[model samples]
Target: MDYIFLNHTADIYICVSGETKERLFANAVLSMYDIMVEGKRRIEDIRKLKVDCINEEDALVDMLNEFLYLFYTCGFVCVECRVKVDEKLDIEASGYYFDKDKDRLKMEIKAATYEYLRIKKDDKWRANIVFDV
Candidate 1:
């Protein structure tokens, strides 16, 4: 995964690959958070959580924002996120949160959009998301 800052505006272009859509989305969030704050990983703890958006793209943004929000507003570190897309097409993630000892993740996640979306050469998921940073 990688990120690019466009020239015209401060928006960020995020690219990620995974075997499945869920994997790609999760990897994207992990990369995004890691970029925001180096080594902001949390210890493993089991918990269940759910987040539902209007559609696939909206759901992706919602999940990403949720993780960032957890870190920013509550200083809640993410241990792991298990996602499940429901029949009605809602995204759910099970994970745990923690306290942040340092403000390592300072960059703001203004917003995300599934503008640049595609599949890779070897059959992998891809997307160039627009961040309102």
Candidate 2:
């Protein structure tokens, strides 16, 4: 569920293993772009958003907002964050490049909320997310 900002050089893979499959946690990541955009809108440009951070719960949110702002201020909507959950169903992700071709960009998510969104002490943020895609 994470996007690697290596253009097409690398692909993003997200694997979730845990007892909790929640969508709210997932939407929190998705909200990144949406919040900055102030709504669901797309951008008509090509750009890359590279992000690096010490992923704590609050840090994660800040990092995510930064990534989303890249497009929000630039007026781009062709962006999505990649978050991969581990066996414990914890969330771990990286930044990705925004892909936009035409003026029209589309973002669809089904689950707007979830029951789980927390980071465990074990490693990798330890989070879970579920969304309607």
How high a TM-score does candidate 2 get?
0.32
Please state the error at residue 89 of candidate 2 in Å: 18
**Residue 46 in model 2: lDDT:** 43
The parts of candidate 1 lying over 4 Å away from their true place are 1-9, 41-47, 88-103, 114-122
Tens-digit per-residue lDDT, 1-133, candidate 2? 3211122222222223223323333444555344222333343344443333344444444444544455445544434333343322343333333435423334433332232334452423244332223
Candidate RMSDs in Å, in order, are: 3.7, 12.3
TM-scores of the models, in the order given:
0.69, 0.32
lDDT of 1 at 85: 59
Candidate 1: give the clashing pairs: 116-128
Candidate 1, poorest ten consecutive residues by summed lDDT: 87-96
Please give, for residues 55-90, the per-residue lDDT of candidate 1 as tens digits: 766677777777666666755555444466553223
Q: Residue-pair clashes per candidate, as listed?
A: 1, 19
